[model samples]
Target: MTRVEINFDGIVGPSHNYSGLSLGNIASTTNKGMVAYPRAAALEGVAKMRHNLALGLPQGILLPHPRPNRDWLDALGTRPDDVPETLRPAAFSASAMWAANAATVSPAPDTGDGRCHITVANLRTMPHRSHEWPATLRQLELAFADTRHFAVHPPVPPAFGDEGAANHMRLAAGHDAPGVEIFVYGLRGGAFPARQHVEASRAVARLNRLDPDRTLFVAQSEAAIAAGAFHNDVVAVANGHVLFAHEQAFEDRPAFYAALKRLLPELEIVEVPASVVSLEDAIRSYLFNAQLVTLPDGTMALIVPGEARETPSVWAWLEAMAAGNGPIRRLGVVDVRQSMANGGGPACLRLRVVADPATVDPRFLVDESKLDRIADCIASEWPEQIAPPDLGDPALWARIEQARRALHALLELDALL
Candidate 1:
C-alpha cells in the first residue's frame, strides 16, 4: 500500500478570539483584549488548505470543536448564565484550531501492528485547553475509524500534561519506511509551565507500541521554553529524515544527536545558530514553527509565516540556507497573522498523518471545491468581529452555535454534532 503524508488543518471556528488563555504563549498574551476577526481568520485558514492542495499535497480538515462548551460548564457545577466571568472564555475558546495540539500520530510503518496510531493529547497545563480532548477524540475516532489502518486512543491521564504532536517528531528515509521517533519533554521554563511531560510522552510511546531502540526521548532546552518556545515544534520540526531546529532547541544537543544518529545515521540537521537569529527572534517570528515538507518533486520546502520574512535576521538566515546547497531548497510564505496573533503558525495549524488516503474518512479530506464551499459558508455565517464584551452576549453565543451547525450541514459531518 502506498502512503502519503496528509496535512489535516483545523478550520478556525466562528468563535475564534484572543482571550490570552494560554499563559506561556507571548503572542496570545500580547493580542489579548483586541478585537478578533473570526470571519477573516477562518477564510485565511481555508486558503491555506487550498495552498497545500495546489502544492500537490493531500489536505484534510478537522472541523472546529463545539464552542461555548456547555458540557464543561455543567461539569463544573455551573450553567452558562451564572458562570463566573473568569471561566467564560475557556468555554468559548477556539484553541482546538491548532490541530498540532489535538493529537500525536505514529504512522503505520513505525507502529508495532503496522497500523497508524493517534493518541489525543491531555493538554492539562492550561485550563482553557484542558477540556479540548473529549471533543478532539470524537473527531479523531470519526476520521480514522478504519480498524485496518488506524488505531485511535483516548488521551493519556491528565496527571501528565501532553500537548500532542506539538512536542513530537518523526524522522525516516521515506514516509513508508521505519523511522526514528523523538519525544521532546520540558521540565521547567522559568515562570512558564512546561507543557509536555516525559512521563506523558513515554505513555504515548508505550500505547503506540513503538520500537524502544528506535525511539529517543529528549528534553527541551529550559532557555528555549523560557524564551517562549512552548512546544518542541516551536523550536524544531522533523519531516522525512531532516530535522530543522534552532541551535538551542534541545537541552543536551550533542547527546541527543548522538543517540539519534545511532538510531538513524542518515539524519540531516539544519540548525540555525543563535548568533545569526537569536532564540528570541526565532520564537517571536515562529521561524522553526514553519512546516518543513517534502515537495512532490522530492525537493523540500519550508512553509513559513509572513512574520518570518518581516523579521530581518530570520529572513536573512532562511534565504542563505535555501540559496546554499542544502536539503531544504525552497521557501513558501503564508499569511496566518490571524492565527499568528494567537501564537499559532502554519505548523501549529496542522497535524501530519502518513497513511493511505483511501482508508481515511472521505468527508474529512479536502480539495479546492470543498474549500470553496467551506469558505463561502464562513463568509456568510461567521461573525465579522468579536470583542471582549461580545463573549458574554447570548446573541453572540447563539450566532456561533448556528454558524457551526451550518458548517456541519455543509460538510455532512453532523455525526460530530
Candidate 2:
C-alpha cells in the first residue's frame, strides 16, 4: 500500500478583488479597495503549483466557486433586482480562492470505518463568507462522492463557526500510520474574534471517529490572534511529524508539545522564539505561513512567498535553518504578491489530503498539460485588473462568466455548468 499526500491548490478566480471582507486579517485591511490583477494572480498561483511539480511533489487543483452566487443571494431572500445596492458586491466574492478553508479531512488510516471523512466548513464568523458552505458542500460531494472510499460529512452546525483545515493539523509517523491529531482553537482572543470554536474542533474529531487518546486540544494565544494571527496557520504549520511554530503561538507552548511527544516520541518541535523575531515581524513577513513540503527524496523544503526575503531577520533565520543540520534543507521562494496582499500566503492557497491518488476523483487531479491550458486561459481572458468599484459593473460580470467557462472547459469539470 503506497501512501501519499496530495496538495489540491485553489486557482485564483477571475473575480479576485480586494473588498476587505475579512475583519481580523491585517493584509486584507491594509490593502482594502485597491486594484487587483486577476490574470497575474492566477498565473502566479499556477506557477507555484508548477514549481511543486518540478520538485517531484504531488499536486492537484480545486476550481473556484462560480461568482455572483445567485444561489446564496436567493437563500437570503433577495433577488438580483431587489437586493440592496450596497450589498450587491458580496455576491461576486472570490474568497473561495483560499482553498485551506474548504474542509478538514481525516484520512482512512485514522477512521474506524477505514474511509476518509471530509467536514465542509461553515464559515459563520464573517457575514461575507458565511454563505459559502452550501456551495462548498456541493463541490465536496461531487469531488469525493465515492462513499466506499470517502465519506463527505456536512459541516458542524452554524453556531459553532468552523473554519476547516486552517484551524486543524495532523501529525503521523508515516502518511498511513495512525498518529497524533492536534486541534488548535482560540477563545476571547482580544479584539479580533476567535474564528475556530473549541467545540467545532472536537466535533470534527468526533465526526471522524478519531482515537481520543491520540488527539490533543490546545488553545491559541490571545496575544497571537490580536497581533494578526487570525488563524493558526498564520502563526504555525505542521508537516508529517514535524511542528514548526512561533514561541508565542500557543498559550503554554511547552505543555502542548510535551503531550504530543508523549503520544509520538519522534515528534519534532521547531519553535522560533520571540526574542529572535517579534510576533509583528512573523505576521508581516508571513514567516510561519510557509509551506513545509517533504519532497520525493525525503528531505523537506520551505516554500515561501518573496515577502520573506525582504525581512532581514526572517531571511537570515530561513537561510540558517536550511543550511544547518535540520529537517528542512532547502528554501524555495516565489512571488505571489497578488494573493499575499489579500491576506493569503503560499499555505493559504492549498489544501492537504492524505490518501492514494487512485482513490480520489480523477477529475480533481492536474498535470503539466492541464496547467498550461489553465494558464493560457488566464492569460487570454482573465481581467488584467479589478477595482472595488468594478464589482458593480454589469460588463464585468460577462467577462467573469466567460473566464470561468473557459477554465471549466480546460479542467473538464462540467459540474459548475
Candidate 3:
C-alpha cells in the first residue's frame, strides 16, 4: 500500500495579528494571506482528491502534529461565529484537550482501518521545564501508540542560538530508526543566533546522521547566502548535490554557481528559478504544508500552498516540482476561498492520511461530468448535516450508496480527464 504522510502543527491565518503586534510574529502575518488562506479552501479539495484516488487503489496516510501555539484557536478567530460551531470549543482551548488526553497514546482517534496515526505533543512554545516534560512525553506516547514504527523528534527551539536544529536532528536520525527521532537543539531559555550558516550546519549534521548513503541536501540560494556557509556546510555535507532557487541565481548566479563548482566540482546542482512556482514564502511563515506524493505510475505530486485562488498561484509549486523531474501526473488545486475567508487552506483544514495512487479499476477517471453527477447525487442524499437536527438518516444513507455506485462507475471510466 502507498502511504501518504503529513505534519499538522498549527493553523495559518490571513494576517499575522488580529489582537496586537505582541500577539504574533511577522511570519504569522505572511501565512495569513498566502498559506493559511489557501489551505482553508483546499481542505475539501484534498479530500476530494483522496476520494478520487481511493476509487482505484489501496492507500495509507500519516499525520503528525508539529507543535502547539499554532493551534486551531490561534489560526481561527476567538469568536464563536468566527469558527464552525463544531470546532469553536476545541479552538478555544486545544491545549487543555491535549492535556486531558495526555495518557492516551494516539492523539487522534483511530479510524478502525489501522492505517492512520496522530502524534500529539505539548505545544512546543510552552516552557520545557521539568513539569512540562511529563506532558510532552505523554503526548509523544499518544502520537505513536498504534503504529509499529514512526518518526518522533523535537524541533529546534526558535529561542535557541541555532536555527537548523530541527533539520539537523531529522537528518541525523537516519531513516532506519522506526521510532520517532527526538531533536534537542539547545538549552531552555537560551537565545540562539539566526545565522543561516549555523542553521545549515545543523541541517547537514542531521542529514549526515540519517541516510548518509542516499541523502541529498538542497536549499534556496537566498537562504544559503543569508547563512554564509553555503559551500562549506551544505554542499560539503551532501557531497556536491544541492538545489538552488532561481531568484538566488539572479541575485548572484555567477558567484553562487562558482561557489558550488569550487566546493564540489562534480556536484549536481539543480536550479529552481523564483519565476518557477515554489512555496518558500508560505513555508517561512508556517502558512502552507507541502507533501511529496508519488503516484502509481511513478510520477510525483507536490501539494503545497493549499488554497483556493481564482488564478493558478495555488498550484504554482507544481511548476517547480516538474522542473525537478518530480513524478506528478495530475495537480489537485484546492479551492479554499470559503475556508480562507474564515481562515486556513487545504493544508490547514483537513489532515492528509493517504495521497498515493490506487490500484482499483482504471475506469475511475471516466468522465468529469459523470463525476459531477455523482457528486450531485451524493450531495442530495447526504445534505450537509449541521447540529442536532441534521444527524445521519437511513434515507440519506441509501442515497449515499447510490451516489457511491455512480462514483464507482465514473472511477471505472478510463479517460476521466
Candidate 4:
C-alpha cells in the first residue's frame, strides 16, 4: 500500500476571464476586464503536471465544470433570456479553475471510518463562485465514487460558510500517517468579509469524523485577511511536519507555535518575519500559496508561480531558503499568470489528495501519456484568448463547449449533456 499525495489541478476553462468578481481577491479586482488566454493557461497547467511527472511525482487533473452555468441561473430564478448585462457575462466565469476550493479532504489514516473523506465547499462568499458547489459536489461524487475506499460528503450547511482546503491545513508524520488537522478561521476581519467561519471549520472536522484531540482550531489574523489573505492559504501552508507562514498569519503567533509543538513535537515551523516578507508582498506574489511537496528523495520542493521569480524579495527568500541546507532544498517555478490574475496561484489551482491512485476514478489520474494528450487537446482546440466582452457572444459558448467535448473524448470521460 504505497500512499502519496496526488495533486489534481483544474484545467483552466475556456471562459476564463476577469470580471472583478471576487471582492477580497486583489488581483481579480485589479485585473478585471483583461484578456485571458485560455489556451495558454491550459497548456501551462498541463506542462506543470508533466513537470511533476518528470520528477517522478504522481499527479492528477480535474476537468472544468461546464460553464456559463445557465442551469444554476435557472435555479436562482434568473431568466437566461433577459439577464441584465452586468450579471450576464459573469455567468460565464471560469473561476472553477481554482480547484483548491473544491474540497477539504481528510485521508483515511485520520478518519474514524478508515476511509478517505472529501467534503465539497459551498463557496458562498462570492456570487460568481457561489453556484459552483453543485458542480463541484457532482465531480467529487463521480471521481471518488468507490465506497469501499472513499467517502464523499456535501458542503457543511450553507449557513456555515466553509471555504474548503484554502482555509484548512493538515500536518502529518508522513503521507500515510495520522497527524494534526488545523482549521484556521477568521471570526471578523476588518471591512473585508471573513470567508471561513469558526462554526464552518468545526462542522467539517465533525463531519469528517476527525478525532477532536488531534484537531486544533486557530484564528486567522484580522490584518492578514484585510491584506488580501482572504483564505488561510494566502498566508500559511503546511506540508508534512513543516508549516511555512508569514509572521502576521495568525492572531497569536507564538502561542499557535507553542500549542502545535506541544501537540506534535515533530513539527518544523518556518516563520517568515514581516520585515523579510510583508503580508502585502506575500499576497501579491503568493509565496505562501506555493505547492510545497516532499519529493521521492525525502526532500521537499516548492512549486512556485513564475511571478515569485520576478519579485526580488520572494526570489531572494527562495534562494536563501534553498541554500540554508533545510529539508526544502528545491524550487520549481511555473507560469500560471492567467489564473494568478484572478487571485489564485500554483497551489490555488490544485486539490491535494493523499491516497492510492488505483482507488480513484481512472479518468482523474494523470500519467506522462495523459499529459501529452491533454497538451495536444489544448493546442488544437482550446481558445487562444478570451476577453470579458466575448462572453456575451453566442459563438464563444459553442467553442468553449466543443473544446470540453474534445477533452472528454481524449480522456474518455463521460460526455457532458
Candidate 5:
C-alpha cells in the first residue's frame, strides 16, 4: 500500500487591528496596517501554488477562514476593491466570523490519473458558540465517489478555550479511505466531567465493534504544540511498527530521540538531521499565512513575508533533496511583491493542492557543493532584472527590488516548485 501523509497549512485569520476597523483607536497593533495586506496576499499565493501543484486543479482542502475581528479591513485601510475576488465573500460571511480560525484539506494523490478529489470540514455556529464534527468525512464521500474507508469520531463538545480537537477533526476527515478510525480524547462537551469521560469512552468502544483493528484509539497529547511554535512532529504507525518523521527527522532533537527510545523499545533509534531546517523560524512565521508544498519532482516551495519582521519578504523555494536531507527536493526561491502593499513571506502567500512523487530521474537533486554558487548567482544578477520604481524612496525601493530578485531566483530553479 502507498504511504499516506498529512501536511498542515498554518493559521489564517482577519487582522482586527487594521485601521479600517480600529477607527478612533490610535494605538497601533503589531501586525496592523499594511502588514495585514501581505498576510492576505500570501494566502492568495498559497492558493495559486496549490492550484499549480494539483496540476491546475483543486487537490487539497483549505482550512477554515480566520476571523481577524470585524472591521479589520477598515483598520488596515482596505477598501472593497482591495480584496481578491475569491476571498471577498469569505471576508464578509458570518461563517467566517463564528468558525474556528483554521481547518484542513487534501488533494488526491497523483496515481498517474488526472482525476482528483478534495475534502473540507463542516463548521456550525450557534448564537454565541460554535461546534465542530468530523463532518468533512461526509464531504469527502460526496466529493470523491471512489472513497475507500470512512472514519468517524464522536462529536466533541464546544470548548471556549481549546479548539485544537476541532481543527484536528477537520484535518483527519480529509483522508480518502473507507476504513474509519475514531479517537476519543475527553468529554463530549463542557467541563471534563468524570461521567462524561466514561460515556465518551464507551461510545468509542461501541464504534469499534464494527472493526476493532480498523478503529484505532489515539491519545491526545496535552503537550501538542502549535504549528506556529514548532515544526510538526510526524509519526507513522503501521502493523505494530512506528516510523518517526517518515524517512528522517526535523527539529525535535532531544525530546523526540527520547520519545523514540520509549515508544520503540526493540528498535534502534537513528538520528537524521533535517535538510531544509535553514530559516526554520522564518518558515514557521511565514506558515501563519502560507504552506510548504512538495512538487512532483520533490522540490518544496513556500511564500515568505516581505516586511515587518527582521527578515525580508519573498517566496522561498528549496531543494532539500539536493542537499541530501531526505526524499524531498528543494529547487530555489521566488520573490513576489504584494500588490496590497503588505509585507509577506513565502508561507503567507500560497496553498498546496497536490503532492505526488515523480517518476523521473532523481538526478534532478542539486548537489551540496553547487548550492552556494547558485545562491550567489541569483543574489548578484537579480537586482538588475527587476529594478524598483522611483516612486518609493531610493533606498527603500532598492531593498524591495533586492528581495523581489531573491524570490525570483528561488522560483526559477528547475523542479523547485
Candidate 6:
C-alpha cells in the first residue's frame, strides 16, 4: 500500500526516424527529412532511464510499439509499398516514445474508489499517432493488470481529442496525499491545432472519479500553443506541491494560481518571466520540458535536456534558481539530443504514474541489469540510421521487426505482441 511516483519511459523503437510527423512541434518540423540515428536515439533513451535510477528514483519502461505497424497499414487497404507518400511516415512513426502522451493517471489517494485509474489517450490529432491507442492500451493493461490495486480504462471516444498527461498536472504536499489535479486544455492555437480539448479533460476527470472540489480545468495559452508548445508540458511541469512553469504557459495565470493556492495552501509557483526567457526561446530550448522530480533525499531536482544548458538565458536562470534557497534544489542535465531534435525531452520521454511498485508488472520495471540488456538489444538490432526514404525499404522494415522481436523475447513480453 506504499504508493510512490514511478516514471515509466517508452523505449525508443527501432524505426526511430525524422519524418516530421508532428505538426505543432517546432523541433520535429525543423528536423524533418533529416537523417535520424535510431541506434543512438534508443541508447540515449536507455541512458536517461539509467540516469533516473542513479538519482534514487524508481524507473519503469514501456516497450516500443511494433513498427511498420502492418495491421494499421493493412486496414487502410494499402501495404507500406502502395501507401501514399504523405501517409508513409505514419506506418513507422516512433512518436510513441514520448510516453507523456500515453495516458492520464489518477492515483488512489485522489480517486473515490481508492484504486489508481489509468485511461489510455486517443491521439486523434495527427494521422501518425491516431492509431497508437490499441497498442498503447495493450501495454497499459499488461503493466497495470493487478485489478486489486489498479483500474485501467480505454481511451475516451476519439471525438474529443485527449493528449493525456502532457496536458495534466497534480499538486499536493506529498505523493501519497490527496492533491489538486489540474487538466489544461486548449481551444485554438492559430495555425497549429490545439490537441487537448476541454470536453476530453472533463471526461478523464469523471472517469477517474476525481473529487469535483479538488479538480480544476485550465486553458493553455494560445500564444504558447502557437509558439510550438504543442502540449502544456512544453511550457509547464508539476511535481508534488511545486508548479514550475513559464509565465505565458496558461491563458489566465492569475485566476489559475489563485484557485491552485486555495486548494493547496503550500503551493509554490516558480514562474520564469518572458523578459528573462521568451516563449519562443523556452520552446526552442525545451527549458520547461525538463522533468521536475523529488529525489529520495526529499530534495527536488530538474532533469533537463542538454539543450537547456546550451541556451545561455535558460542556463543562467536555472543556475540562479539552484543557487538560491528555492524548493528546486538541484539541476540534473541529461543528453537526449536525439529525442530533443524530434520534439521530446526528459519530461516528454516519461509518463508519471503514482502507484505501489508491487502492484505493477515486474516485466515493465527496470534495474541496471535490465537497462544493460535493453541497451544491448538496441545496439545490436536497431538500425544504424534511418533516412526518410529508408522507411519504405523492405529490408529496413524486416530489420525493425527483428529488433522489436528480439526485445520481446529478451524481456519475455512477447505476449504484448
TM-scores for the candidates: 0.99, 0.97, 0.39, 0.97, 0.36, 0.99
lDDT of 1: 0.94
Give Cα-based local distance difference scores for all models.
0.94, 0.86, 0.30, 0.87, 0.29, 0.93
The candidate 3 region of ten consecutive residues with least summed lDDT is 14-23
Candidate 5 lDDT over 1-417, as tens digits, reads: 333332322212222112222111112112233323323333343443344334322222222222321244454456534543333322322122112122222223321122232323222222111222332233223323343322223333333222222221112122233323323232221221111132343343343233343333343222222112111221111111212222222223455445434434543322223343323333233322333333444344332233213332212222222355543333223333432122223332222222232311222112233333434443443222211121123343344334434433453522211
User: What is the lDDT, from 0 to 100, of the residue 113 in candidate 5?
Assistant: 29
Error of 5 at 163 (Å): 4.8
Regarding lDDT, does 3 or 6 come out ahead? 6
State the lDDT of candidate 6 residue by residue for 1-417, as single tens digits.
Answer: 788999999989999999888999999999999999989999999999999999999999998998988898889888666877777799899989999999999999999999999999999999999999999999999999999888999999988999999999999999999999999999789999999999999999999999999999999999999999999999999999999999999999999999999999999999999999999989988998999999988999999999999999999999999999889989999999999999999999999999999989999999999999999888999999999998778899899999999999999999987
RMSD of each: 0.6, 1.2, 13.3, 1.3, 14.3, 0.8
Candidate 2: list runs displaced more than 4 Å.
Answer: none
lDDT of 1 by residue, 108-193 (tens): 99999999999999999999999999999999999999999999999999999999999999999989899999999998999999
lDDT for each residue of candidate 2 in 236-290, tens digit (9 for 90 to 100): 9988888899999998887997898898888887788898888998999998888
Which ten contiguous residues of candidate 5 have the minimum total lDDT? 231-240
Candidate 3 stretches with Cα past 4 Å from truth are 1-140, 146-148, 151-271, 275-289, 304-326, 337-417
Q: Flag regions of model 6 displaced more than 4 Å.
A: none
Model 2: how far is 310 from its true place, Å? 1.3
